[model samples]
Target: MELAKMTPLAGLVALLALAGPGAAETFTLRIGSGHAVGPVTYVNTSRDFLVPEIEKRVAERTEHKVRLIEAYGGSLAKLDETLEAVEKGILDMGHVCFCFEPSKAMVQNLNYFIPFSPPSAVQQLAITRKVYDQNPALSEHFSTNYNQTLLALSGYDNYNVGTKFEWEKFADLSGHKLGGAGPNLVWLEGSGTTVVQTGIPDYYTNIQTGVIEGNMLFPSSYFGLKLYEVAPNYKIIDMGAMMVNGLLINNDTLAKLPPEVTDIIREVAREYEQVTAEALDRDQAAGIEKLKAAGAVITVLSPEERQAWAERLAGLPGAKAKEFTEAGFDGPAIFRSYLDAAKEAGYSFPVAYAIE
Candidate 1:
């Protein structure tokens, strides 16, 4: 039988039941993630915080028969390989950061390059979930290509202008040396700003040595990476929210699980998704405060400045959609569906670009 032809939900239940409840029998699953356990005084909170939570839930719900062995902090796999790793069962499940593979994961990063009206974490999460739920084709694309299931979708905090140079408009970026991830390179175009491809880990020193003038990143991540001390200016671009991470599981692994065990996993994922969202919301506000206390200047783009930047990239939306469709997916339609659903859910982008 074709794997795609078989629906996922029921298959999962039978597999778990077959594993049986014999006291002597133990089933082990290895899940991979990309953050390490750190000291109590760490700059960024690790996935270490989530490990115990998952273990507790699994033990309580599965009679302690299933063990989720974890590979943390890219020890088992790195971000770019995670999607394929999970699908090929190189690891049962893993953390997939789309930003690392934006070219291949266009649909996943559609919003990463766009600007948000409020640029609030809570609003971004709400809109993301609604957009994900409303677009099955977008959801299924993952299943079809990676042979994995997207357990949950979440967004990171908004990107702030972290730089040695202060910026309030797109033009201010001109002649500036900047480092950025994902599609942020587009922002440097026509502005004379030179784009440096520095990974997040190198952002701090790169700025300090004059290797780059500034970089764009989420405040939480900037704090996590300690870029504030070197650059010391946190400018709110309001361009868009950043999506740093998500989790995916091998479909074959998921299909092999007993329905009850699968149910437990799904429930735990949903719970953690909410926990993550709330934490991100709080962390975003907290990060800004922490950076401000540390002497970082925060710049909020005025309405006129925001519009000017938006105008410079006037047809960016169409170009993005077309790029996706040209890649053999319904990129334009997928993009439209997300926006329409967001509007339906009461999210109105101040400047609505008519997507083809």
Candidate 2:
């Protein structure tokens, strides 16, 4: 006989087996991130700000039934391996650097690396969110290739030079050993300087040992990593914002979560998304103050010089965008939309560099 036509006992046993795990146990999800337990750092912001916020939101929405175990400061896994770790279930949730996984999400990081584009953190984050929300293929690609889901993005500031020497313009930067990460290399290309590529965590030592004359970084990173003591010239270039980082979760873990819990997590991400932008502004101001107190030279690039530098780097972005588009994502269009959004947001690009 068919199972439906069999016994009542068989039906009850089947139902019990199907519902057993969900009804019998409480789930403790382990959320992992690379930053330390407290404030934001070069490693990540979501670990410091977004994780707690998400936990609070989830608890409030789900009646405190769900528990999340936070693994911070690479206690669970290395910073560069976050995406892979999440995919392998070594981490249930993580703050992944899309730059580190460029093969998986080059379009997103290309916005950061493309020179002379994305003028502000708010605009950058806005466009990134819009693009991800609109592109099903991109989202599916992340899910299928990495087994992870992008929960939120942490925007970056316009990188500037913090150096031992005064640099009033890009021309003044010639022949300096500027330590920086990926995109800054492109920015410094024609400046006649040697670009020393080093991790943010290693910047302090690199400077202290005279391995680099200066480094390009956002103010928060300069302050967070104590770069002020070594190279104290803070010069704002306003070239563009870096993509900085992203928060992601294991696709399987996210899929298995109660829908309400997942919704709460995303809700908190939407709220914390602005934290990086606002914090960047504040940190930039604070970094200027700290540099002044430390007797460092601060030079704001003049309007004419900033204009020249902008024009010089402008072509690089389009070229890089083509490279990304060829790899299959519409990088040029994404970059254009980002710039257009920045214009719509009332940012007068080439704001005359002046001391406030």
Report lDDT (CA) for all predictions: 0.69, 0.68
TM-score of model number 1: 0.84
Error of 2 at 242 (Å): 3.0
The residue pairs found clashing in candidate 2 are: none
Report the lDDT of model 2 for residue 151: 69
Deviation of model 2 at 223, angstroms: 1.6
Query: Residue by residue across 1-356, what tens digits does model 1's lDDT show?
Result: 65656468778877777776533334577777544433111112225444555566667766555666877666777656777778889888777777677765766787764555346656666666666777666667778887988876665666767887666667777787888765667765678888986666567788889999878777777777677778877777666665446677888988877676678777767666666666676777787888888778887878787677777776777778888878787777767766776676676664667677
Q: What would the per-residue lDDT of candidate 2 be over residues 1-356, giving only the tens digit for each residue? A: 65547489998998889887545334577777655542244234555566667666666656445566878777887657777788899988777766555466666675655555454676767766666666555566668678887766775566777897876777778888888666457777788988987756578899999899888776666776677788877777666666557677788888787777778877777667787666655665676676677666677778788778766765665676677778887765655655555567655554322111
Candidate 2 Cα RMSD (Å): 5.7
The list of candidate 1 runs beyond 4 A from truth reads 1-25, 35-50
Candidate 2 stretches with Cα past 4 Å from truth are 1-25, 37-49, 114-120, 348-356
Candidate 2 residue 148 Cα shift, in angstroms, is 0.6
